[model samples]
Target: MGNDGHIAHLTGPRRPRALSPLREHLRDTFWFAPTAGLLGAVLLWWAASAVDLEIVALLQRERAYGAVRELMSIAEDAKTIVTTISAAMMTFIGVVFSISLVAVQMAGGQLTPRVVRIFVRSRITKITLTVFLATFLFSLLVLTSYESESSAREVTSVPVVQSLMTLALVGLSLVLFIAYVSSTLRLMQVGPVVDRIARETLRMLARQAPGSEDGGDGAGVRAPETGWMAHEGRAGVVRDVHVARLVRVARRQGVVLRLIPRIGDFVMPGTPVLAVHGGTPPRRALLRYTVSVGVERTFHQDLGLGLRQLSDIALRALSPAVNDPTTAVQCLDRVVQILAAVVHRPLGTVHHRDRRGAVRLTQRVPGWADLVDLGLTEVRAASVHSPQVTRRLLAGIDDLLLLAPEERREPLVRHRELLLQAVEQAVPEAADRRFASHPDRQGIG
Candidate 1:
């Protein structure tokens, strides 16, 4: 039993639809944005060319020789600018992104390889790449429309609108370039990367529909004794589950469906995926569609991914190779931030019921104990030698103890005791043990 009042918002009538596999795949890709930009650039060039032709016709009909000469001169300058942009934009893109990728690679190595996913899914990265490509393509297209002869009397059309649009695109690319550079630099830092992961985790938690308390524990529903659905697709991690669809199918078939593996669990082919209680199991294909499998886990539905990532960073920081305790402390700060949010919420098994109050779908979620262990266990073990990490671990547990309910304090207390024991055994000097024993929010001073 968890805090019902604090979790009431999570028990809602509407359940979010599972993100499709294709949609999820596209979201992590860098090419989609640039491809879209190229198409948009083509359309823009067509429209600008049409407008320029209309303006040229209007000026000629008015017999404005002076204005036409001025327009021709502007077009001449426009050609030079467009030519420069078209020739140099791609090279600029290559140089900037090549450096960015190298920096991202180093950061990933310093922290965790999972950090690269943050760079891929970054909106600023995609948008900047898109604008750069669009600018280059627009300039190239505009160049093709420039007139060979530039005499006011003989000038059939002047690309005034096209030139203006190219200039605007170039300006936009420069602005985005600045933002992109700043964003890439932040990715190299530990604090910002950890914060982003934690924020994303909290957002996923907010999106989760925990269902009603009655549905929290399948109180009346009997265990599924009929059959099981095995995984038939290619082996990968379970990324998302179509809970709404599963509920509907179960309700229609008069059965209760329990998901076998959690969202982040990696399953091989022929692995049991669902347990059927009463009625005949749904089509295997239908069950397969409801679960999304990918090569790696993502934040799409994995609630524990953020904590796991933070733990990875902490472990990497404490590793003998890197040996940076300050970075480990930064990781603990964000880990505490994420765990604090989960402390008060309803967790563990969730039940989705139909209108008749019958349980239709039941899925296992990480409980408070599981999450506490996931976040702290490895870090505590690896931090025995690092007094900074040991103190921060104690402080994090103490902070969690204050916010956690009576029932939830057990995990926090257990972790705190285990951390102290590890520190005592690992630290040879009594003074070091005493320093590690004292809880310091900053890990030392």
Candidate 2:
């Protein structure tokens, strides 16, 4: 069916559990690991210094003079060296942070706002921040033990071990800073970002379609005719569902638990988020915990989000103020590939059950047709004026129609007609209309 909402709740086969909010947040947040790791690093260095201080003291007490004698001057200057390095690193961190924020802002404006999440979740960005902050902490800790003196040194043994380690960390951070700069610069480019979005979409397609060539159609007991509609307790996007747990609870209660909101769907307080059929409605607490809601949609299980992201990029490029047709064309290429993958793959559907095959969970997933509408309809409308965008749109639709089954033809034809209508509106001349309607990868005659 063309309508996603038309798919009624029904039971299906069981699936896996989803990550806890705390765990998912830790994974999504850019600073969590780095911040935690920096603290750990500080503790580790402090412990090392504690142990090494005694070793160095013993050597000094014995009037040791071999290798130690050679670096006595270096040790003497350790305080000044560590302090300078710490100050420079902190300053560098401020500058880099400011620049990165600018890049994020530019990307948010130029590309899709969702893409900003990509840059924020970047491993390199997180690592760079961690290194710089850690280096600052390291140098500061080393400075605490910096022994200064006129007659006798205020510090003992210059904390030589700590000095060397701090220097090493500083050097490593420098290398990472250079790499981070290169990565952030690359992120600013339109081509790489479009490709990345497309790649992630394709990856999700593969993940959602894994296991068999069979349709992802789930079969289970019909949802009870009468059921209580469960409303959302909080406002947020339905990020993911712990399906296994849902199926288990539904089976235990001998009822069909129809989750109302699909992953990626935005829900607010009082929105119908679930449908409880039979068996005393599973505790609202259980249902709420089973469904993971968040402020923003994530790429974790929402394949449509990735397509929406690419579509947004294309739309932004085609905007009157932007008017970058070439970028739109580039985005369309990825859209074409994503649609083709969808046609050839299995889409996640509601049909989860336990080992006994008794259907306990009936979930509503955006059907394949719905995804096509999401990925193409908006971009098609936006890019109509650009011949390149129009032609690519036709070609993408042609490819999808070719791969889709006979049952899906009606929806595909409707989409094709919609594209033609958009083409007519965009191109005044018959010759231009004829050229735009023709499906071609290059987008124009």
Instruction: Using lDDT, give the best candidate's number.
Output: 1
Measured on C-alpha atoms, candidate 1 has an lDDT of 0.83
lDDT per residue for candidate 1 within 1-445, as digits (tens), equals 1111122234445544445556766888889988998999999999999988888888888988789888888998888888989999999999998998899889989999998999999999999999998999899888888888766767778998999999999889889989988999988998899989998898777667563233333433586458888888799999887766777778778788888788899999999888888878887756658787889898877889999999999999999999999999999998999899988877777776665556777777788888999999999899999888888889889999999989889989998988888888888899989998888899988
* Candidate 2 per-residue C-alpha lDDT over 364-398 given as tens digits, one digit per residue, 9 for 90 to 100: 55666777788878887887778888887778778
Off by over 4 Å in 2: 1-22, 57-72, 148-158, 209-219, 223-233, 251-255, 355-358
Against the true structure, candidate 2 reaches a TM-score of: 0.84
Instruction: State every prediction's TM-score relative to the real structure.
Output: 0.89, 0.84
State the weakest 10-residue window (summed lDDT) of model 2. Answer: 1-10
Lowest lDDT sum, 10 consecutive residues, model 1, at: 1-10
